[model samples]
Target: MALGTIFQHDTTDPLAVITAPSPNESPEEKAAREEREAEARGISDLIDEELRAERAVRKKEEGMVKILLLGQGESGKSTTLKNFRMRFARDKWIEERASWRAVILLNLVRSANTILHALSQEMDDEQFGLDDAFTFDDYYRRYRLRLSPLLQGVESNLKRLLGAQPEEIEPQKQTHPITLSPRTSPEFFVRSRTWRNFLQTTRGPEVSGCSLEQDLPDIIDSTEAIANCKDDIKTLWRNDIVQAMLAKRRIRLEDSASFFLDAIDRLSVRDYEPTDEDVLRARLRTLDIQEHELRVDDDADAPKWKIYDVGGSRTQRHAWLPYFDKVNAVIFLAPISCFDERLIEDSRVNRLEDSLILWRAICSSKLLSRTILILFLNKIDILEEKIRDGIMVNRFLPSYGHRPNETSEVVKYLRQKFKDTVRHCSPEPRTCHIYTTSVTDTKTTAVTLISVRDGVLRGYLKQADLF
Candidate 1:
């Protein structure tokens, strides 16, 4: 204040006052003052830059639509999101394919383990009356011979990524052990930072062998070993002992490791590349929500698409509310085939009933009243197969009374049920864009995706009064 008053009130030459430094000020003090001024300028520039960036993001979001994939666990939400990437951002998908190799191998190993466990169950349980034909020693010997190498390879891969097995990697106790079958239990995902680091840093080791015998030695040897023992697998599947056990337990072999059993010969091949269907059928549960951004083009005006793949389990639903307000649309996946299945979180609730309750709550929520809703009645393929196998709908869904158990009739009935639920519960009456989707089928899903995109765009435009 004293310096300011002298400058303002004193009768001094203007040029002398402006050009002269204070007489008592040392060179060091002047230098420090300059340094402080420069830092202040830098901070001011940074703030301006951040403000510009914020504006750009806001502008981009104004033109972009954010889609949230929602469903109960195993309802194919992630698979649907993967299909979007496969269609729109193919280059990125190809780049990530190498990482998926480990996941595919893990899937194969888990399948083999499951089959061994089922066989073990048969030998241990007297209720199945299967002890006379199948002994643990014989089955165990066959498993060790045919599957041990692959299991070892899986272990090696896991060790490289995690330095620990899947069970040892942050193992958690089951929340609903009674309701969930071990088969339906949540499986591991290759989403850890350690896995990413391994994939990025490591390289495959070289091998020396004959061309015929060791083609693709870098491709895990267990893969070749499994391929070589296809005959043994088929024999195990067709064994009279297994057949008797199946009949006694009425075990639906078609549902679990049956896919691997059927395709052992093809999957075991050294050159095998996973198709879109193979990736979809791979059963790693979503542990957390994943976000992917796609830019349609490099043009300034090209719209950005932000797609969120949310975890759909009961426990994971709590994380969903934070995302609801800003979402432009929701692609709700409901598996029509899960009518006979029970939820892994709570066994008392049938899977289909759980889906209905979830759908109703979503439809009725005021926060999402303006959001476009596209209902994917997914897994129709599985539903058709189940119906074909004489799985009576009324046995599990008593309300589906006296309905024809044929695929077409059952699908139609299920569709109407969803339609009715939406009509009754939706806060703002709106038409639900429903599709009977087999998300595993690429062609069908692509077509449905186009339709959904158009529907969501139209809804958004209408909301903005720009349509």
Candidate 2:
């Protein structure tokens, strides 16, 4: 009876009658039609399964908090992320502490080489008295020859650690693998996602192959190379002539993010491990967006956080849009200390001005309008240092208008400026938690982070009706 009904429906539909299979269709054609239908059904099932899985994961992560770290290059975004990892993901930070030894070694080498070059340039540029000229020339020739091997090895050592072969990658203007060497770049750029892997690889083996420290303690090969020239490094770094050259030429190595010159004695030993402060202070520039997940607490029900540290150079700003989706908050770091400094990318633009431009743009983005905005007027320590050194805020920013050039007053004034930018530029009403931070000072930053964590938890509680 069912078969007869099916035949009746097919015969009654005029369109079906015309579209029906040919009465003289071959067996091969019938098999092909059935095969095509089966394949189409299989594809549809696969897509449905993926959709279901994605939804399930999304539901599981309902309590997850997503925070994006945005700032200009050298504004301390990566440093801020390090603090989060140190506090929330303590075990991982400890595990990776040894890996940072190589980077620190590289930083020290870079500082030495920078002085070497600066001394060379000073000798070439200046026609000092006979005694002064003789002293500089001797210093230049002796240290340059001694540090020459390190100069040669640093580039190769850095490349091997980054997992890039000479033939595979080429350095170009406005691109990745920006040399950590000061001669080429003031900031070191690395692939963010695999940041620790390369550093870990180079930790103990490549610099001095067959060293037992690789297996025992993870002391990097750069340690041995650096150890060989430790005295020369110390002498040159502390030399009156070198300091004079740096000061007069305005090559302030002390002002750079990778300033490890102060800790040469502690850092130059084999089996050396980076202290938490050392790790926090280390310089490793991020090239692309890096995602790190941390369990904010030690409970089964603890909220997981997905922190995104995006690259902050002008060219990298376009990559930030996709991450603005579903973001819970943003921590925008504006380095107020850089008021008198200019950007590495564009010399015409002051660093503090670039930071302000970035802050305003972030404030005005409609996508981020509803998200929590935390403004870190970071590097307060540097600001205070500059202020005490008689650097006037009014000199760079006439709008500062002769405010008392004290740290507290400067911070207060800049905080108002940042707050005003958000007030005027945000697409809608929002709350911005502004903090004067010196992120490298982990002790103080810990207190700041506690407030940040508490606020995020409160929001989650309210959402779950448990507050």
Error of 1 at 232 (Å): 3.1
Candidate 2 lDDT, 404-427, residue by residue in tens: 989999888889989999999999
Q: Which runs in model 1 stand beyond 4 Å of their true positions?
A: 1-52, 130-141, 144-146, 150-186, 192-219, 238-257, 295-302
What lDDT, from 0 to 1, does candidate 2 have? Answer: 0.77
- Which run of 10 residues does model 2 get worst, by summed lDDT? 176-185
What lDDT score belongs to each candidate, Candidate 1 first? Answer: 0.70, 0.77
Best by TM-score: 2
Over 1-467, each residue of candidate 1 has an lDDT whose tens digit, in order, gives 57646545443677757745575778998898789879999999999999999999888788887899999988888788888888878876655554454456556655554455466565555444355645655665666567555445543453334334556543334473222243422356544345444434332222112122221344456566667656776777667876665555544332425666677777777677766666656655545668888763456664578998888888889989988977889999999998887776786888999999999989999888878889999999999888887889999989889978898888899899889988888887888899999998899898898788777777777777888
TM-score of 1: 0.79
lDDT of 2 at 409: 91
